[model samples]
Target: MSWLVTGGAGYIGAHVVRAFQAKGIDTVVVDDLSSGRRSFLTDDERFVQGSILDGRLLEDAFEKFHVQGVVHLAGFKYAGVSVKRPLHTYQQNVAGTSMLLAAMEAKGVDRIVFSSSAAVYGTPDVDLVTETTPKHPESPYGESKLIGEWLLADQARATGLRHTSLRYFNVVGSGTPEVFDPSPHNLFPLVFEALLDGRTPRINGDDYPTPDGTCVRDYIHVADLAEAHVVAAQRLDAGEPIEPVYNLGSGDGVSVGEIMRAVAEVTGIAFDPEIAPRREGDPARIVASGELAARDLDWRMRHSLTEMVASAWEARRSAPVDNV
Candidate 1:
């Protein structure tokens, strides 16, 4: 089946594209290349250098291709940056999604798979969060994602547009050597960058209640997350009842100290991390319950922490860097 993957040039989107290609599906990508790299788009796939805010482009893309599904991965995702630049984040994440939904409605596209985040749950008192967890976003980034999901649900209820939004945790790791997030905001990539740059990475907040007094998080490999998106798309394509939301994670939290230890072990780096005060809105612990995804989409993560870090490090070492 043919598909339209918005932001298909970004880290997660690129992995999703690869997953579709493996299944012999012809997927077209529409990316503005603002945060995504043009090099990430495979030669075999059709690529459009554009944004989701462009209604005419999206409509034309729908008309030109036998688009059966749309994967909404295009949005501003930096939590810290979103706190400082709320308007810009909203314009892109919220308004841009509105534009995409409008285009979908105009084109008669009903099925959508949105890339959501764990940030929507804010700081859950429980270690693992389920689909029913209340959305209490602490940052504009999380708020934008929550709004996107709400838009999908509202539009679905109003127009019979089915959707599946997968709220993901820290998505870390690389799918292949050619495609990797060169400058990453996530913990693992930053740590890998620090080691590569011969600098000590800063580990924020070491006084939490967890073991070693550091924060804990769920880190899902990108490949596994991409596969889950495919499953979600397949469910929607089958005209199955949309479950609305699912949390994609490993169901267990890994501490910052544990992650550092794993990185050091993988890279053979003896660098010590500087302990810094916790950033604002930083959650001490955030994991996800994949029971819903498993029940509905049959999704599960296959990579261990060590494997994820090692794969990321390999990409960092060999990945071609484009100076900003």
Candidate 2:
């Protein structure tokens, strides 16, 4: 069965692509290279360079590949950036998803594993965010992802398309030497980059109600997250039904300061993080419940925060630096 991985050249998408390929499954990719890198795609997979919103391009790609299932990972994801450019976020995420669904319908593709975000839960009142939690996304990026889930669910009910919307939180770690996030926006990569450059990594807040007074988040390993996509695909292949939402997280929240210390320990760098003002629209704590995903798809994370930080540091160090 040929699988179509949209945005397959990005960090998490590349890892998902590799996971599918490692299982000796045939897969194809369509990535615009806006933030995604061509370096992430393997030699064996068919690669199409384009945006998901481009209907003509998607039509041709879908028809050519005869895609059976899709792992939809395309869209903007930066929480802060979304606040700055809400319209751009809505246009790309919502419109891009609508275009993909339309193309899927046209191509007779019936199954999809949509990449949703834990940001959809916003600043939940509860410490433990489950699949049943009420969604109150704080940023446009989160709102857009939630809307994507709605589109998938609505389309599925109308068209009988099997779909799973996996709500993930703080996807960290590296998959292979070839697949890595260079100049990443996430905290771990920023900390790793700061250590490598001999600079202080910036922490957002230092006075939260967490154990050490810093904001805590669920940091699930990227490889583990990537593995979940494969598992979701298998479940779809088996003709099993699933609830529309599955929260993919480690069920453990780690603080930003703790992450800095871990990076320093892993990279052997004595780095002090500069504490900055907390960014707006950030929740103090959001540890998601992956019980639904584990029970239904048999998926669970399998890496420690230390392992995640170390692997990311290795990938960042090995990749070439840009100095023009």
Candidate 3:
């Protein structure tokens, strides 16, 4: 039996699909190709192109592929845009997850590993966040993810479904040159796009109360994040104890200024980032303690900041101009 990965054509989802494949686990991808690319998946990989809101499509995929578990990553992912379009965000994230859960119940798919967000802790007061950190989601996107976790928990309590949620901040780098991050909203891609187009990369706000006077955020490699999903799924499949939620994060964060410097070094481009006004609702620093995830899922920051930048740059440069 194969595991179904929703939004498997997206960057993180593609890496997760590959991670499961590396462990001799089969995967069937279901993506609408909204923000994901068809080329992100391989020819041999099973793919069903449709929105998760369509319960019939999900049930058909489950039956046809003999699916056992699911890795739920399909949703509207942009926080800034989510603020302007709360209705669309809730529909795609909340309503879509509800539909997927309903389909899973109908098809007897009883396990899931949810792709959650660190946005659930909006501008946390503490220096280092933990699993127990009080959730104060500032955006509709974050609120929807919290709701997704609630759905999983409530479903598990009622239907005996085995599930876990992974909350994380910045996901950077590429596991394979074939699969590069194509997100227009992510920092790495935004910087790379600016550099590729011979434009200066702008730091949102350089006056924050950070060491470098810019916002600091925990950054993890895409491959590492993908591996954590595999581990979470394995624990569920093997009936091993798993936390309802785990934070995959770096206890220490890297400043945006530091990131800009790393980008300059990696790309061999020497240009100071333009200082732009801070966007409203932007936090000064938001890092998390991954001690629990490390203890449970073998989570660790395998790649350094320089490695993260270099790998992302290499993969970004490898992509076609139009795709980037």
Candidate 4:
């Protein structure tokens, strides 16, 4: 039986797929191509083009691929846009997850690794977040993810389903040159696009309490994040006891100012980032400790800030101009 990776054609999902394959585990991809590109996947992988919201389509994929477990990564992920698109976010993240779980139950595919978000902690009051941190999500996007985790937990208790949710912080960098982040809202992409279009990159706030006078947030490499996912899947497949949720975070975060400096250095384009006033509700620092994940999922900061900037810049440059 193969593992089914929902949204496998997307950046993080694609890296998860590769990590699974490297461990000699077969993978099947289910993506609607909403934001994901088909070119990001491999010919050797089984492809199913459909939305997880369609229960029938999910049923068909489960049977066709003999799905053993699911790596559920498909969802409406932008926390800021979720404010205006609350219904869309809930439909895609909360409802879509419900549908996927139902399909898995029908097929007896009892294992899943959910792609959750640190957004669920929404402007956490603490300096370093932990798994037990109280969830007080500020946006519909974060609420949707928190609800998704609840679905998994409820399902697990009712039907003996084995599952884990991974809470990801600012997922930056590319695992391979073949794939790049396409989100219009992400920082690295924004910086790269601005530099390529001959516009100055802007920092939303420069007077924050951070040492560099810019916002500091957890930034982990996509590759390290994906590897942790695969490791979690392996453990679940082996029926090893694992936590219900893990945060893939960098204990100490890098500042936006430092990121800008690295970007300029990596791209060989030296220019000061335009200073814009802080976006309302923007926190000075939001970092999480990955201690739980490190103990259970082989998680570690394998890439430094310099390496992340360099690799992301390389992949962004290598991607075709029309791809983004």
Candidate 5:
């Protein structure tokens, strides 16, 4: 039986596929190619081009690929844009997840590993967020993800479905040079784009209480995050009990100013980032404890701040100029 990774052609999803392949696991992909790039996929991997919303299509993929487990990563991921397109977000995230679960039930594919977001916690009130943090999502995207988790819980209660959800923020860098984050809303890509376009990157706020007077946020390497996902799936397949949720985070966190310095140093560019006023609802510091993940999922900050910037910069530079 093979593992089916939904949205496997996407940046992070592609890395997950590679991770599974590295462990000698047979895997298949089901992606709609909405935001996912076909160039990121490999020729050896079996591919199913379709949306997760089509339960019949999912069932077909499951049966054809002999899918025993799923890593559900297909969804509308933009948080800010979700506000403008709330209905679209709900349909893609909520309805799509429901359909995936239904198909899993019909096909008897019980194991699932969901890709959730830290947005489900909104702007957390505490300094360090854990699994037990209050869930008061600030955007429709976050709410939809929370609902996705609840759907898994309800399904597990109804049937004996085994599952886990990984919530995280600012996933950056590359596990393989073939895959690079192409998100416009993401900080790493935004900064990399600015430098490549001969423009200065800007920091929104520099007067916060952080060590460098900038807001602190977690920035985990994509490779580290993907490893945890594979391990979680393996444990579930072995019938080992796992935590319902885990936070892939950097306990100390990195600031925007520090990231700017790293970008300049790594890219051989020397210019301070332009600083602007802090955006409303922006928290000064919001990092999470990754202790639980480290204990159970083999999680750790394997890459440093400069390493993160360097790897991301290398991948971005390696891509074609027109690919932008």
Candidate 6:
């Protein structure tokens, strides 16, 4: 039996698929190529071109691959744009999750590892966020993810579904040159794109309360995050005890100023960032403690900030001009 990874053709999803392959576990990718790239998946890997909103397609893939579990990563994942398009976000994240769960139940796939986000805790009031941090999602995307977690919990209570949701903030770096983040909204790609185009990258704000005067947020390597998903799946396979959620976070966060400096150092492009007005709802600091994940999933920051910057830059530089 194989694990079906929704959105496996996307950046983080592709890394998760590779991690499963490295552990000798078969994986089947189901993606609609909406924001994901088809070339990210290898020719040898099993792939079903479709969307999770299509329940019939999910059911068919589950049966065709003999899927034993699912890694649910397919969803509308832009917290900022979600405010302007709330309905679309709910449809893709909330309704889509409901459909996928129904398909899993029909196919007897009793295990799942959900891709959650730190957006669930909008502008957390504490210095370090934990699993118990009160959820006050500020955007539609955040609300949809929180609803997705609730859907998983509700389903688990009704059925014997074994599941866990992994929450994280900025997921950066590339495990392979074949896969690089193509997000137009992410900070790394934004800086890389600006540098490649010879435009000085801009920072949203520089007057925040952070030591560096810019906002601070957690960043984790994509490969490390991918490995944690595999371990969570293995635990479910072994019928081991697992929590309903885990935060794959860096206890301490790095400032936006620090990231800009890292980019300059890594790319040999020395230029100060242009400081713009702070975006609405921007938080000065938001970091989480991954101590729980450390004990349960062997989660740790295996890569440094320099490694994250260098690897992402190398991969982004290697991508085709049109893709960049």
List the pairs of residues colliding in candidate 5: none
Q: What is the lDDT of residue 55 in candidate 4?
A: 95
| Candidate 1 vs candidate 2, lDDT winner | 1
Instruction: Compose the digit string of candidate 6's lDDT tens values, residues 177-266.
Output: 989999999999999989889899999999988898999999999999999999999999999999999999899999999999998999
Question: For candidate 3, lDDT tens digit of each residue in 1-324?
Answer: 989999999999999999999999999999999999989899999999999999999999999999999999999999989999999999999999999999999999999999999999888899999989999999999999999999999999999999999999999999999889988889999999899899999999888887889999999999999999999999999999999999998999899999999999988999999999998878799999999999999999999999999999988888887776
Per-residue CA lDDT of candidate 1, range 162-210, in tens? 8989998788889897777655677877887787788998899899888
Compared with the true structure, all predictions reach lDDT values of 0.87, 0.86, 0.95, 0.93, 0.92, 0.95
Model 6 vs. true fold: TM: 0.99
Count clashing residue pairs per candidate: 0, 0, 0, 0, 0, 0
Q: What lDDT score is found at residue 206 in candidate 2?
A: 89
**Model 3 regions more than 4 Å off:** none
Ranking by lDDT: 6, 3, 4, 5, 1, 2
Candidate 5 residue runs with Cα over 4 Å from true position? none
Model 2 earns a TM-score of 0.96
lDDT for 57 in candidate 1 is 96
What is the lDDT for 77 in model 2?
80
On the 0 to 100 scale, the lDDT of residue 6 in model 1 is 97
lDDT of 6 at 163: 99
Mind giving the per-residue lDDT tens digits that candidate 2 earns over 1-324? 589999898989999999998887788999998888887777766999999989889888888887899999989888888899999999989999999999999989899999999888888899799988899998999999999999998998899999988998888889787766664577777776676677888988888888988888899888888888898898898887777889987777788888888987888888677989987766688798788888986777788889988888777777766610
Put down candidate 5 lDDT per residue, 1-324, tens digits, no spaces: 999999999999999999999999889999999999888888787898999999999999899889999999999999999999999999999999999999999999999999999999999889899999999999999999999999999999999899999999989998767778899999999988888788889899889888999989999999999999999999999999799999998888998888888888898988878888899999999899899999999999999988888888888878876665
Superior by lDDT: candidate 2 or candidate 6? 6
- Scanning candidate 1 in windows of ten residues, the lowest lDDT window is 315-324
In model 4, the worst 10-residue window by lDDT is 315-324
